[model samples]
Target chain A: MSEAIKDLLKKNHMSVTDSRLQILDMFYHAPGALAHADIEKKASDKIDRVTIYRTLQTFEEKGIIHTIPTADNSVKYALCKDQCAEGHHHDNHVHFVCDKCSKTICLDDVHVPEVKLPKGFQPHQSNMVVNGFCSDCRS
Target chain B: MSEAIKDLLKKNHMSVTDSRLQILDMFYHAPGALAHADIEKKASDKIDRVTIYRTLQTFEEKGIIHTIPTADNSVKYALCKDQCAEGHHHDNHVHFVCDKCSKTICLDDVHVPEVKLPKGFQPHQSNMVVNGFCSDCRS
Candidate 1:
């Protein structure tokens, strides 16, 4: 886990510090993605609150992790899985937030269907989030 | 239109006022929904910025509208088809945000499927947002 963080930091041109390692660990352990509050609770014993926030920002800048928006306007994040840039990623798949566990998981293979837009609008990045009860929670 | 807002307000026991009506109007005309920033842009000219904010807060509290989390952590509001409590709603369907025109549209018919959760977790409310170039913007 630590090695993964180090590699990510090095690749992203960020410092592979202990604080960042712990924060990255949270993402590593997370089956899907997580909210700031989730990271705070899970990683508080290792990383400080401010450091986690900074690490998230830094990781996002390096394209190591990408932000996934939810229904509450709270920013959640997941690992890039090697598809992100300093300013963007072509993450055009469905993002699932489990209502059962409150965990945000990226549905990489599931793509959101194309929508019709109005004129004079340029295409940019896109994101898709689906919220519902997970299979485990339902059972 | 005025009667609609009045009816919503009265049913919810909220005070009916112009600012509230205007803010509600934006949500009404909005095919998807509007962010606070979007609301301010359409409404600040007629209502006080603070008033708009307060009215939105009240509307959210009273179940008139609900918050949708976006990729940037920006809060988006949509009028609930059925009255929803702060954390409860019957319309837990898919929501799409067009990257080209920055529009949030309700995909009420597009329902999200179930997910599998880890243990010891409770599932509650959920929000789903799909961001992409709308059909018009693509053209």
Candidate 2:
């Protein structure tokens, strides 16, 4: 785990710091997307709120992770695929929020479909969030 | 404008209040959606942050307005159509975020297309936000 985290940081041109390692490790093990409150609750006492916030921001800026917007005003974060890089993100996939478990699972295989926009509206990117019961919850 | 606000509030079964009137008035005149910060900046000094927050919550619950999630974690609110009712929202249209003007416009005519999900994932509601340059921006 530590080696993988170190390699990811190196690839993103970020320094291998304790805070980054710890946060990255959390993302690696998270079954679904994580909210800021979730990280604050699960993070070690040594790491403060501001540090966690900044680390998440840096990770996002580096394209190490992508954000999933929720209706309840809490933005969730999940690890990005290898296609993502600094200042660029290719995570054009659907995000599933389980209504029963409240787990946000990235359906990487399901790509967001294109919408027919009105004339003069040029689309750069699109995001789709589906609320549903996950397979795990159903089982 | 005042009459429309009052009629909308009465239809939603919410009593007309000064703060509610002011906030709803903002939504009515907004070119696109309005965020909490935008409300705070435009609201009168008599209205406090807490009042604004509570008013938004009530309005959402009463189905007077619907939330549009943004990638920046700031949830924007817009007025709902007549189809919406208490605890039920029929605002299934796509939301467009203008990259240049930073406005979140509700494309009322463009409906969200259904995506084929994996088995066991029962979809309840879906939200699609497309980021691009609005017609005004392009023009």
Candidate 3:
């Protein structure tokens, strides 16, 4: 896993650092999207908040991760697929937020359906978020 | 307009105050959703940031306005329709974020289409946001 992380950072032209490696590892193991607080808690005071924030920003800029917006204004970050690259993202899938467990999962297989806008409206991209009970919580 | 604002506040069981009235007025006249910075700027230093924050919270809790989540994690607020009441929001319409002008408009008539989740997922509510050029910017 650490070897893969090193290669990813090298491919993105970012230096291999402990903070970046730890953060990326957490995303790899996360069941769903992770918020800033989650990363902070998982670091167990080893990494400062500023470092985590900066690492997340750098990762996002390099397209290593994507952000998921929530209704309550708390943004969550998740690992991006191999399609994503620097300054370009192809994450067009729908995001699902489990109401029971409050976990946000990327439904990569389910694409966002196109909506018919009023005349004179030109669409570029669309994002859809569905609140529901995930498979784990359903049972 | 002031009388209408007062009545709306009264209906929500909130006392009419300068800060609340001013913030509510901003939402009424806004062309699109207003963010925290927008509200603060429109207040012209008459209202403090804390007051503006509290007023927005009160209005949201009362269902006077609904929040639209943006990709940048900055939540925008817009006035709710008459159908919305305290603790209930019927703003299921699609939100349009204009990539050209950076305006987030509520397409009241464009409802969010139902999405088919995978098996074992039970949906409760869905929110859709489309990014594009609005009618004014299309030309």
RMSD of each: 4.8, 2.1, 2.0
Candidate 3 residues lying further than 4 Å off, grouped into runs, are: none
Residues B1-139 of candidate 1: C-alpha lDDT, one tens digit per residue: 4897789788888777778778887788876788777777787556777887888788888777877666667777888887887545667766666776777766666664444334433345444555667656665
TM-score of each: 0.69, 0.91, 0.91
- Model 1 agreement with the true structure over A30-106: per-residue lDDT tens digits: 88887778888886565677877887888887777888777656778899876487877766666666765776777
Summed over model 2, clashes come to 0
Model 1 chain A, TM-score vs. native = 0.86
Interface RMSD of each: 5.6, 1.1, 1.1
DockQ, per model, reads 0.32, 0.77, 0.77
Q: Please give me the DockQ of candidate 1 compared with the native complex.
A: 0.32
**Candidate ranking (DockQ, best to worst):** 2, 3, 1
* Model 2: per-residue Cα lDDT over B1-139, one tens digit each: 5997899889878899998999999998999999899999998757898988999999989888988977666878999965477888888999999999999999999999999998889898999999989998885
DockQ: the better of candidates 1 and 2: 2
What is the C-alpha lDDT profile of model 3 across A8-52, one tens digit per residue?
999889988889889999999999999999999998448999998
Query: Which lDDT tens digits does candidate 3 get at residues B1-139?
Result: 6998899888878888988888888888899999999988888547888988888888888888889977667778888875377787878999999988999999899899987888888898889889889999986
A138, model 2: CA deviation in Å? 2.4
